[model samples]
Target: MATSVLSKSVLPKVPKTARKTSTKTAALQAQPDAHEPDANKTLNLILSRLDDMKAEETVTIDLRGKSAYSDYMIITSGRANRHVGAIAENVTKGLKESGVKSVHVEGLPNCDWVLIDSGDVIVHVFRPEVREFYNLERLWTQNPAVAAV
Candidate 1:
């Protein structure tokens, strides 16, 4: 005959003290996630503001020590000529508002790919074909752990 639910044998239990320690350890593990700097979050906010201003395919690559350019490379796409110009403008405005200065911007006349060189971060706003042709991620694939977001 099959055992009734109430008659089933229970597994060995963790001691009360060990259970408390495990719970505390789990809480500690959760703590770091809560207070993390969230670099991606900040990047996304900037990208959203860029998108709100119609910047497309916005991607950021963490390039720490990979190149002298900056710690991060942020790339975006602009659907058309005018959109590229607008994307540059909005990025500049947003960066300025965020207390970032000395932004060296280029490539607006053709609207092919505008590069905004901030000291610690480089933002590239590009036309789709230009971005696809260059394939920057392929060039930097050695550091794949650093995501382009």
Candidate 2:
């Protein structure tokens, strides 16, 4: 069967047995980083999963008005090209399974920057350099909520 995007939010306080198998993630965020970990709990759940799965730079942009694509833009980085691709694939699959319906995805072959457009959310999987060069969070800091942070 042709694959579809899956998107589902994890339920409250539930610790996933399939913990992030990445030591790097634990090192990166020893403390609870980022804002709105609860209000955007779903997005945060995805981030934690992706992070546990070795995805880096896991950021969510609240694009409630900044963009029409969705209320949030999630960005993450992979250790390498292969890792980046893997993160994108997992994210796409997860979204589809969750019934999120990934309308489109791009930049898989290169893996430098993969864009998964899943209606309400757009996921960006990028290499560290690529993420730094783009600095999406900086550009998206216009939101009052994010700006306050």
Candidate 3:
């Protein structure tokens, strides 16, 4: 003889009032500023993380007026590839835990130079040789007059 099996029942409908309030709450939370920390706060958080990770030659270049991409560009060096990767990983994790919604990372595999873009702040973690070769601080902080002419 074949046995009959019963499926689970459907969920009860949500009350309209409950649904409306939840939808409104979600909409309010979806606003960009509602969740984003202040740009300066985020920058400081990143800097502190880099320091804690023992990143060397840390330099912060103001990119507010110069670049539309980010408000600040931070360049720092690590003793080696492993150190570079660790610095990048630590900074990325720190930013996320500190309420940063999104963090983008690149060049982590080789660890020659790792770049982390955390909304308002952009951080570069590079091996000493890589940092010297790129010289990002000089490039970004150069005098506009000198660069133009």
Tell me which of candidates 1 and 3 scores higher on TM-score: 3
- What RMSD, rounded to one decimal, does every model reach? 16.8, 18.4, 7.1
Worst 10 residues of 3 by lDDT: 1-10
Indicate which candidate wins on lDDT. Answer: 3
Query: What tens-digit string does per-residue lDDT give for candidate 3 at 28-112?
Result: 8777766577789988998998889999999988877777778888999999999999999999998888888889999999999
What is the per-residue lDDT of model 1 for residues 102-127, given as tens digits with 9 covering 90 to 100?
66889978889888876667778878
Worst 10 residues of 1 by lDDT: 33-42
TM-score of each: 0.61, 0.63, 0.76
Where does candidate 3 stray beyond 4 Å?
1-30, 143-149
How far is 78's C-alpha from truth in model 3 (Å)?
0.4
Cα lDDT listed for each candidate: 0.72, 0.72, 0.84
Residue pairs with backbone atoms closer than 3 Å in model 2 (clashes)? 5-95, 5-96, 6-94, 6-95, 6-96, 6-97, 6-98, 7-95, 7-98, 20-52
Predictions ranked by TM-score, top down? 3, 2, 1
Clashes of 1: 1
Predicted structure 2: lDDT: 0.72
Relative to the true structure, candidate 3 reaches a TM of 0.76
Tens-place lDDT per residue, model 2, 53-118, is 788658777777666546688888898999988888887776655555334889999999999876
